[model samples]
Target: MKRSSDRTIKWLILLTPTVTIGLWEYTRHAFLLPYLSMELGNFLAPFIVLAVTLTLVLGLFRRLEQSQRALRRQQAATASLEERESLARELHDGIAQSLFLLAVKLDQLDRTAQDEAVKELSGQLRETVREVHDDVRQAIANLQQPPSPASDAWVVPLRELLGDTAGVLEAKAEFRWTIPESRLTGKEKVELHACLREALINVRKHARASRVYVVGESEEGGGFRCSVEDDGVGFDGDPMKAKERFGLKMIRDRAAKIGWTFSAERRGELTVVELRKAGADA
Candidate 1:
């Protein structure tokens, strides 16, 4: 929708003046020459075209932008609903079932376990209940979050994703964005969005941090960079070599494919994932 609107505006900008000029000249020479002078017509034609552009073409451009914005919001809202349903299904089918099994086994153990095994079984039951309790709390937090509004600015989705991740992790999420609208290409935005989402997923599953900070900026010399920093216990080992960390690998591969530099490392007390795109000339 956005692309079509943009293309229509571009065509209007390019063709409107040329078509108007051709018709003006044709009418002046073929029909109006006896009535209107060449120099006077020439002087009036530019103002006439400008007036038409300011009124007709610009009006259409604004209208198209408005329509596109409306369509995008509707799409976002639909996707949000679908995602919420999927999350609810996951909680019910996956976590809820596991919790039910744990509760059942704990009940049987409590009823029949001998004194010697009681300590171990009790510890196991406690651990299972704690895990289930945490999972339920997180799920409830996620389901209770209000949806954010959609808009042309990329920050809406960015903020929404961060908020959701924060709710799931029960972490404090902070981010600062300074990348100007014109600084990023559409491809850059897509890559950044996916990478950041993966990075936040890693934080949720692995970081166990109380605070997560995501920073994005348009650097000097046209460069763009973003960093996801978490005050979590740093990776147990090299994040790239961790057995279950396909997310880190995927982020690296994606950044490489997109010609951006990616890094995950412990910086002071924070585990940081940084992705950087070089200046255009570089």
Candidate 2:
């Protein structure tokens, strides 16, 4: 509607001078010719036309400015809401995942409580608690930090997560990032990081891989593709049997939720999990 109004305003601006001139000419020749002399009317016509034309043009331009300002405010509000959602996802991936891992460790300790040495169990429990505390502190710090515009703002934390996962699995991990242009939106970045984190965790828990390789690259047409490849024994049964594995289901659900393509397959000696956004390859 604003665009249509802008077009109409432009046309009106163009016609303002013409309409004013025509009205002045009509009044001077037909209505006021007897009352006012032709010489005086001719002298006054240009000034009258200029005044009316300025008034109409200025008023239309002011309205256009007001419309543009309103549009800008709306866009800013949308962006702010998206940023908040991104922050929420970040918190989920960070603090929530840490708590889940802590729970798993505690469950493991409980199961082995009858068999394991008391000293060893106590040590593991303390370490797990410390790790959880650190994660919570880091998450709070991240929440308080101002938003960053840097393209690689997500890189550092993702690398750290992969490294930590590799340590847990006692496997070698390597990451290659070839994102020449980081044009990902806030939601896309959050989903991408979460997907990669889930992939590494899956590898750590299930894949008996000695080495893992993660790659993020620009795709051909215009989009991005990230793959987690491991030289591990791949899934033996149907990969899509979601009921059997909760982690795979979570990863797939997140990708689907965010409108990204996700696939996991065994390619010879390597199992690969890939995520791709539709138009971010460039």
Candidate 3:
């Protein structure tokens, strides 16, 4: 439609002067030769035609420039989609495959273990590896999905994640969140979610807790913290022993990378894992 309209407008622009000139010549010869001379009409007619043509040419140039800009924007969007897909493929083929292989190895260990403790440990390792494999695959799936124009509220995805964990871990879970919307940035939300995921996984695998309570609350000033507490067979001997655990180490490293504080400890009969960051705006 736009192209057709442009063609019609261009033809009208070009034909208007031709039609006017023909009418002027015919009228001058037939009715107004005494008043209007041929030389004056001919000379003035060229100027009028030149001015109209220049105006139309400038308008056409502006439209063409806009069309080019639209084309470039479309090309950029296509390139971005291709890049995202390529990254997803790399993750699936690389990290995802490696995780699957590790899970297989753990399964083999579980089968070949001589003692009950080793067999149980191997079984737990296999479960953890499978969970990590699911997480990586989910990340790749998210990448494959089209990017949203705006970020979502933090609680939305966080709630869904916790709900899934509860079902998978077969534990009763309660989530109470009161942190403000402005509390977490996009990157901060990712780190916080990762930490929470690891904490919940720990509850499922190690804590043996039947009930889990998760609370997110604002701190003094503008900082915020989230705690995952469980009435489990709390941490063993030393909190520092968590350094040897993969899930704890992963969450702690994620928090450290984001300059947030992460800690896991025993409080009475409940095991508590907390992740927090102080806001710069405070």
Considering every candidate listed, which one attains the maximal lDDT? 1
lDDT of 3 at 176: 85
lDDT of every model, 2 decimals:
0.80, 0.77, 0.77
Residues 1-282, candidate 2: write the lDDT tens digits.
877887887888888888888988997889898899989988998899778867877888887787786677567756865786677677777776777677677776776776557747756786777777777666656655543432255776777877887787788988788764235667877887888888888888888788898888877655778889999889878777846577777778999998878899988888999988777333
**What's the C-alpha lDDT at position 242 in model 3?**
50
Q: Residue 236's C-alpha lDDT in candidate 3?
A: 72
lDDT of 1 by residue, 39-88 (tens): 99999899888988888888777767766766776677678777876787
Q: Pairs clashing in candidate 2?
A: 222-281, 223-280, 223-281, 223-282, 224-280, 224-281
Stretches of candidate 3 exceeding 4 Å from the true structure: 1-153, 242-244, 279-282
Deviation from native of the Cα of residue 105 in model 3, angstroms: 60
Candidate 3 TM-score to native: 0.43
Candidate 2, residue 241: Cα displacement in angstroms equals 0.6
Tell me how far the alpha carbon of residue 242 in candidate 1 is from the true structure, in angstroms, after superposition: 1.1
How do all the candidates rank in terms of TM-score, highest first?
1, 2, 3
